[model samples]
Target: MESTDLMKKINSFALRSFRDNADRDYIHARMAYRAQLYPQCFWSSLHALEKYAKCILILTRTERVRIKKNNFDDVGHEVLKSLKMLESSLNIILSQQTIDFLKRLENGARFRYLEVSWHSESAELTILDRAVWELRRYCNSGLYSYENSPEVKLLDNVKELLQDIENVTVENTHIAGGRLEAILKQPKSPARKELVWKNLYFSNSKRKTVWLESNFMAENSSLFLYPEIIDELTKYTRIPKEIVNAYKNG
Candidate 1:
């Protein structure tokens, strides 16, 4: 499809929907992290960040935003670059640690392939949680009050958009913040500390044996979805079990 026609298919309402999709990605990332599916976690986190960045660009940039297929034009799968563009364009700064985390995620294929890699214990997920929180804040603000430029107004549904922007109220997704915020900002609990330790060295034979023997595995049993890990994540992230189960079932 032509880029302009594609842009016409997207509007402020579609832009607002990114928050919901990103929230689901955020939830999935945490679930994968809890499940010790680090590769999946990395991809999910990257996806969540990419969507948030694109959403931000759509809201703040006056230029035409081209989304061909599932890939953002000139920004395919490189979340760090997308975020840098967002930072430069919107003057929204991110911490050096967050930048480093996104850089690590940029090579997510390595993690997926189980190649030798370096990732911090708990810190990766924490950075994702915090970054998502900040980005979601920008999205919510833009959704409710952005004055679309004349160029943006060319997109379909812009005329009907945000009539109730003042009435916009987001629920407590991981981005909207709750337990995840507390976990990010406050001290960790003993279970959380242990979970982090286990995640850090999940390759240890003894820990792996115990972890496998435990009932933490998902319904398939081969996937090894740990309940204790989920509990720890829930303690910190406050994602509902239904959402976690949705990820598990699908």
Candidate 2:
């Protein structure tokens, strides 16, 4: 959901940057789809998770979610830019060096890594988790900069948002990079899982659906898919009555 709005903003930014691309429409559609699916197909897909996991940079903003570590010391965005560029061409077109570089960065889980801390990698996983969560939140909230303008105080917007975040002094809060790794290693929830299905998707109508039921067995990343969600999705496959009865009856 955050990515949906983010895709629009990113496209707007691209338009401003490129002025015009001959293949603007094609690129736009691809970028938008990836903006939504990259996290799912490439990153969230356990089968393919490792393929992009190393490229998944953990970013953090102390004042606000806008200031990338790169503008200061954060470089994760740069990695994302490069990887996205490579992803633009799915074929053997992006060059081997580019792929190699990304692979190296990903293997170390230190590639394109960015954050504000001049601290130790103590709570590496925990810090990584926070960084991912922050990026997700950033995608949801929005980022702003005065790069093209002046008289703007740096990190002021972040300060504004920080006023609202209920910063709790929870346990393991200061183990440095531990947070980030924790988030990175954690599994994504499946679309048809219990929390997702029961909380946001499921309804009496969902029961009669059949498409999801059919595909449930076909999904590659069923780990995120909750069994309860699968059961719920069986109800809403949109299949005809005979199948629905057999499904509900059986």
Candidate 3:
């Protein structure tokens, strides 16, 4: 139960991991993956909790969209609003003290992460099987290539642990470019990027400053989003009849 012992166990689990088995870079990447999986605890140990939340909120959306530059538009408006709500909600839950404790490491990986399980042996097997299932599906669908992609190494755990995995090829997948929701990544998107930059950034101000109190100019406000809410509410929430039967039979 000692920290040293727990780390040793995690390392042992990694050594036996499918990812590490594939290659060394994979080994390192897998470590990062594990940390991200439980960032609630891992992030706090490395960087300040407040910074990590900002990083996660930013990076997650960025990765989702894979934006080289920025994209701002009417579609981006909703995303900005959602971010404000999400940020406020997170801060409200974590509190200032806990946020400080959690956010000690935002720059790089240089601290401890919470272990998945006490027994490295079991943890290895579990992690491996999940990787296999996830990657094989991507591979079968033609969304990934093993020879060139880090995705193959990521699935190392699955290849070792899965007993009877159905081989999935790239042809079997429907997702292209990683995932469906890819447009939300750019700083050009509505909310803070443009609003903050144009309104908040002034001749006297500097960049990277998150200024809250300013002569911020919001768009001419009316019943802007209220109509969309009404539109969604009027739409039927019922599932299709065929899918309903499939679920019932299962």
RMSD of each: 16.7, 21.0, 23.7
Backbone Cα, N, C clashes tallied per candidate: 0, 41, 33
Give the alpha carbon lDDT tens digit for every residue of 1-250 in model 2.
Answer: 1244554455344332321221122123223223432222222222222212222211111221333433433333133443343232211122344344334334334211111011222222222222222222222112333232221122454444433323322221221222222332335722122212211111112232222111111122231333334455557554334433543454
The lDDT leader among the candidates is 1
Of candidates 3 and 2, the better by TM-score: 2
Per-residue C-alpha lDDT of model 3 across residues 1-250, encoded as one tens digit per residue? 2254553443344223412232222222234334434333233222222222232233222222423223322222122222343342222122233333222223223212211111111132123222322322312112212343211222344333322333333233222332111212334543223222322111123433232222212222111223233334336553334333433443
Q: Is candidate 1 or candidate 2 better by lDDT?
A: 1
Candidate 1 overall lDDT versus native:
0.50
TM-scores for the candidates: 0.49, 0.22, 0.17
Residue-level lDDT tens digits of model 1 in 1-250:
2264444445444455665566567767767777777667778888878777766666555244433332446766676666655543344555677677777787644334322234435445556755665455555432332233422322233223322222222332223332333333444443333323333121122332123222222222211344335545566555545545744565
Kindly report the root-mean-square deviation of model 2 from the true structure over all alpha carbons: 21.0
| Segments in model 2 whose C-alpha atoms lie over 4 Å from true places | 1-105, 108-129, 145-155, 160-250
How many clashes show up in model 1? 0
Q: With candidate 3 superimposed using the best TM-score fit, by how many Å does residue 148's alpha carbon deviate from the native?
A: 25
